[model samples]
Target: MEHHRSISDVLIIGSGIAGCVSALTMAEEGVHCTVITAGERLSYGNSELAQGGIVFHAENDEPEILEKDIMTAGWNHNYAKAVRQLCALGPDVLQELFIDKLHIPFNQRKPGDWFLTREGGHSLPRILYCHDHTGRNIMEALSKAVSEHPNITVLTKRTAIDLLTTHHHSSHMDFKYSLANSCVGAYVLNEHTAEVETLLSRYTVLATGGIGQVYLHTTNTPGSIGSGIAMAHRAGARLLNCEYVQFHPTALYAGKRGGQRFLVSEAVRGEGAVLVDSCGDAFMKRYDDRADLAPRDIVTRAIMDVMLKTGDDCVYLDAARNIKKDIVKRFPTISERCRNISVDITSEPIPVVPAAHYFCGGVLADLNGRTTLERLYAVGECSCTGVHGANRLASTSLLEGLVWGVTSGRDIARRISKTEPMSEKLRDSIRDWVNAGDEHNEDPALINQDWATIRNTMWNYVGISRSAGRLHRAFSDMRTLAKNLQDFYKNTPISKPLVDLFHGCQTAYVITLSAMRNRQSKGCHFRAD
Candidate 1:
């Protein structure tokens, strides 16, 4: 095994909004940061797929109102401090970063007034969008800024294998005797050369996004397989709300049960699209008085119940009949995507189903994004700040990522200036990655099969609804699968698929275990028995 080493003031794993914001924020303070991602492009994550907009301050809106909406949506399980921080700072950060700094072309009603839209859990229309392609537009501008920044280095096609912690990766026995476990950096695999590089940094941030890919059907990109959570958990970081996985209520259902599902943005429902059964009977009113505007958990269960009762695999979103706005103009991307499948949003209903979308729980972190482990931080969907609690309000994902990204970045920069880098002797004591298997023995077929088993197990047993029997069976199956994957990982050469599969399996075990431990139903972690 060959070894290459690089050092930076800050190391950011995952190039989504959170990672980019962290990098840019620190870089502005003269900190040289390295941002890495597993995908070929920096824009290949959930942030880029965010069709809805981010939260902003609407007219006559108070921070307390937004806080109440968030707490209500989260079933009062939210961390009040985190919620308050988001409501207080989110709009200002959005204005400073996206509006004033980047000058992103968000939709505008006039020369001075911006166009705002509503989502499922909001009290008013407070989301700022760029038509329906808000994320694409935001990522495009943000990635460009990151690429051009002299203090930031963007490395694509780099997969983070694991966190480098003193308690685990240190070669010195005496260092393990210390009370604290500190992370120095990570072992990152360069996909182009298949070489593991030791990326040492004064501060390491895990913004690796969500765990949607762990389920059979999801709106997340293929890369979102809980790598960050798996790495943090292995490094002894505390995880919170692992059982609360939020399923989006309306994913475009094309009669498929697996792979990435096209998301029917909740903003569509906010625009008046109603969920109806095959017989065109509106059913959300039966479950919640808010009907189409119910929170994601309520909407998802309603859709599921309707599907089960009607013997239908999917329901329909009738935007054509309800939304008075020009459907094609308001949602050009959705219209085009539906057009490809011979369903025009302007004329009829679009087929939809529930799919895994977001993870409200993750590696426990604070408002500053600092994890339990020293010198390591987590932001974005990968970190549980306790803001989302049991379920996330629509469009808040992007805002949380942005706000925490800036906060974490500023916190790291402020601290890094006074702290010295790791000593040479201590750095030298960290060992490099060593491969134990024949590189030729790696089989794509086996990796694919393992991933399939993981996704199917999560979706079937621990999905939108759960029972004790289902959770027990899931735990048993995942336990066996975890052991098998551990053995396979030890014997197989490193690859992107292999690393993702290993992480996915570990994450599945964590989620299932968390579900089994909790007896009461709260938000998204509903138990049938």
Candidate 2:
């Protein structure tokens, strides 16, 4: 069959805030852009799951306060320049996304006051919210905007399995044309159509979000398979600090099979939700004087410690006592989800457990969101832009995505003028990949299980706390899993699940490798070594 996909100016591999913002910026520049997304379901990316809301300095809020809080929360190791830049740019990005383009219906106090709320780790009320489902609000707005764009094509349910490259170019003159050397585009697998297609572009942006799904128990969506980071690593992009994983303090724990729990928004705590022990005693005050407003790592460990010491099934989140029944009416979405599970926030405490929530590290990128790979950009939770070092401040992931996404897109658009479109040589390499896509065959089902193995290994060894011994064990487990996955992937027929699993294997090893390098306990990365 003849390949039909024409080259785009830039092919972005996600549909969340980052990818959408990138597309918006690129389209304005008249750079033809295409976004290849994880699923047809809108806002399926982690951005839509962010309940804490986007952190930005309201005009009334002090900039120094936000900066100090972030610096202190991230333990001072985070990149000051990037963090400062992000913080400075936060309001602009927020305005661009929420007010200028997506038209998110932000709650307001005085005509146009972005009714801000407070979350853990912030000293001031700085988060802009839309009821309780902030991600949903933002996602809804962005989806509408992107779908209407003429220059931007949003390809849903298409996973960028591997980046198209020529690291070892077919022609000597091509000289390592690669996502590693320089991105040509990506090999995307469309799940609904069951066809593998080669997508070509001058720039390929990986806005693929977080890897919290690497843990057996996590708050991330099923799509958070670490595909972008894993593919980027294989394409020879530099990765950093893959070890640091953040655990949210309170997920509505309902005894899931993998101990997986539904995310109860940090905004609950931001809205005065209290943490209580097994005996129904308010306990966060005992752990940290800041109480419900403590940083996520501290909050997670505190809950875990209480659970371990009391030998209880889980702790309780007790907002029923302080928060109003009427406000619960306002947050009907969250209130009802909890109520459906028989945990009425108006009368009883919700059973809570800590679950892996965010990855603080990933494929390293610069201030402009440019990865080591030329013409390849990344934003959101997937790229370690150093704005988040060992830990990320609440609501900052989407904020970072907003700033870097726009910046990266404009830069790529400017660079597109000097670069040639997808070459015949590059297309041939991608053709070979797509041809190999049809040629090879192996057990995809077994490859799927390796993903579980990776999740189990991370959750067991490199979870909320870690030690040299545990890390070593994790490395061993990761290696074994990787070997099995590589063998399976090499021998298997090309499929979306297979590609995702192969990515998982690379992610596990990279995370383990990054974990083994860091020796101190700081922020999300806790180590006894």
Candidate 3:
């Protein structure tokens, strides 16, 4: 009964760093923006769970060096243009927005000097962190700013079902699929009331973060189920590098099931922590010269190799010996989390394993964040600006989100002032979303079973180390599972849980299919065969 339609200058999906930054930036430009989130609060995404810091340049750093590090980590498959934009624009944005404007209290070594740390694949210490919970601290500042912004509105517990496009109005329309395919808004489902609303906007941005929930073990938050990517794909948006899923090298191996896993920050390694086996023997030296400092792909593969060779469930990170004194002070969040679980970091080695951490690819966009579709843009982990290439360097995700968020926000705000609002006829033509079927999914157990199957299939076949046979099998299984889900979807009432399952399946299928297409072994998507 609460079903309705609304309009805004910009409608940003996902309340992570990218979405919040975009909204705040646009609001500053006098644009009325709306941010919709799947969780109860804006801080529920992967941004808040990020343990490592944001990457930025030091005064002595050169753009070429930063570019080289990113390209090398990505195995040179990166979009040169996007990478360059990030390298050049990131520092200014950090100073102007995060430091000067927002006044974020980043950790500092001395008065007026930032406390910088290095992560894997970076040449130097160019990362500015706030203790170990860098992302959480950043999110806290962003969330507070967004809440106080007069031109911004934040909606929680809303799930975007699909994008509203011109094609949705008429099947017989002759509009070209190129730039003519514009996104006017989105159809969103209210989780609390089970009502769907048409949220119309001059520009629609998808900053829905990563697709890590499709994997069995992930360092991503629960809300990262790939809804934006799925909805965009369904609406004919071009997605690039879908195969490049970055598995973080070290996630706390709690042997737990469901929800997000605890991340062991790469900064721990930067502080001299080494990956060791059950016998306390360091082994990364045999795999790569950089050893613990190697790129995420190399490190994750090395960990997997160690686990297989040793027949152990996980490896140990010896931070106790390397970072003994300031262990609790330097990484208070990690220390407290481990202590809660009865694992004292200062006295014992932390058990860790590789887990799906970030999605390097998504709705393909330019440096300005414009996607193939007209009036539609994507940023953050959900957008493939190609800054991350085939694999992401550590701590670069937050910076990428910040840069693109500002780019998209400024561009959208400028265009909104010049462009006319969507026509009333076209808006009316976008059919009211109806759940239709009176029947519930009689067996809710089927949803859980299918969800588990998709995650397990991706983990077993399409994970860190992939093969042609494995990819093929995963593709087939996902395709079949998708069809079954589609059938059930048509007959059941729309709900957030069901939509999340549907989106997860679509994202998994895309990843598997992309992996199958790229036969060559490269960053992240490594094929042993």
Candidate 4:
């Protein structure tokens, strides 16, 4: 196979907020960066689908107070150091990067005063939003800046096939004898050209977002199938808390509306929306004292229990009677989407169900975004910094991504300056991606069936509630499916769908195995047995 090589100071395998932020931070310091996305559009990802808001410092808000809220939501399972770093430096980073540098027009009460809103798991109104389209607005600004920046190169429709580790990809046998493994770059598949390119860099960052798409129902973008996690796992990066998959309590229930569901922002509940039965009877108060304000895990489980007991397909989110603000104006995006499905948020209740939303577990990384592997960093949803712990706090996802993006970018810039470039011999030792079988052997029908089996198995046996029996069955089934997919993957031509299925299968197996090993019912990893 012929090889095409591209070099950069940094290679970021995502185009979301974290990727964009990291690129911008490094580029400003004269470091060249290459940002790639599997999606056709640079702005398409889980970050673009975010609606609730990003956490900020509210009036009289202290780092300790925010830390307490986060710990409470995470059930005291959070890494105290990571939580401390985020709570202390997050606001400053937000101000410097988003406000001062990017000039993102976040909503304001008046000049000099920002419009802060609350969300589930937050103690106060400490979230900044751009109407109900916070992620969209933030991405628009970041993507534009990244595209125009002279030091940053944006590549779309490029899927990362695997991380290029010295121990794994090097043609030299001596590299295998080295005590430590270092990531040199990645083998990326260029969709437009149908060719795999060797993308080499001094440093590599994985900002690839959530794993929600692995489930049957999710509030994530289509490409979020745990590709980054699978790639990192293949490279032997340490993974933490792989069982904690957070399910959003209120995804609009439009039956058979593809895999991606329209998320009813938690800000709606923060604005006074209440979860009720079909008969308009409020039920959250029965589950927790905080009722609608409870952490996502509690709320998601409560909704599931309600559904199981009542034998209903979905529950109702009554925003019409509770929220005093004009629903249309305050949540225009929600209103518009709801309207498309013949549901009016201003006058009626929204049919809602819990859907796979966020993954609290991922490749282990530190506060500076350094993973266990040398020269490889992970930020955003893909990296488990131990900040979110067993469950994520509402509105903290964006803040976590932002804080780490800036820190990782700055750290990489500093490290790269002192680090020597890869030697010509070492660089040449990295082998090109090879095709193992006939390109025409890939069957789309078989791939789609495999995906369906994985999704259905995950949703049924490993979803909101789980048991020893269910998890055991899930592990058995996924283990078999993963092996089959691996075999199919080796012999099939590398297409985007084929690659996604392979990654998805591997990720599903990881999550299932993790779920089976942990017997405790904590946060999102609720083991009924």
Q: Which lDDT tens digits does candidate 2 get at residues 348-446?
A: 888988888888888888888888887788887889888877777888888888888888877887888777766665666545353433436555566
Give model 3's TM-score versus the native structure.
0.97
Query: For residues 292-324, what per-residue lDDT tens digits would candidate 1 score against the true structure?
Result: 999999999999999899998899999988789
Better of 2 and 4 by TM-score: 4
TM-score of 1: 0.99
Candidate 1 lDDT score relative to the true structure: 0.92
Could you give candidate 4's per-residue lDDT for residues 58-120 as a string of tens digits?
999999999999999998899999999999999999998889988888999786599999999
Whose lDDT is greatest here? 1
The local lDDT score (0 to 100) that residue 427 gets in candidate 1 is 86
lDDT of each: 0.92, 0.80, 0.89, 0.92
lDDT for each residue of candidate 3 in 1-529, tens digit (9 for 90 to 100): 5578898878999888999999998899999989999889889799998877998776689989999999999888899999999999999999998999888878886766888888899998999988888888899999999988999999989999999887764233443343366788899998777799889887999999999999999988887888888999999999999999999989988875755789999999999899999999999999999999999999999999989998999999989887655888999998998887789988899999999999998999998899998889999999999888889988889999999999999998888889887776666666667666767654678878988998999999999999989999998999999998888889888887888899999999998999999998999989999
CA deviation > 4 Å runs, candidate 1: none
TM-score of 2: 0.94
lDDT, residue 319, model 2:
78
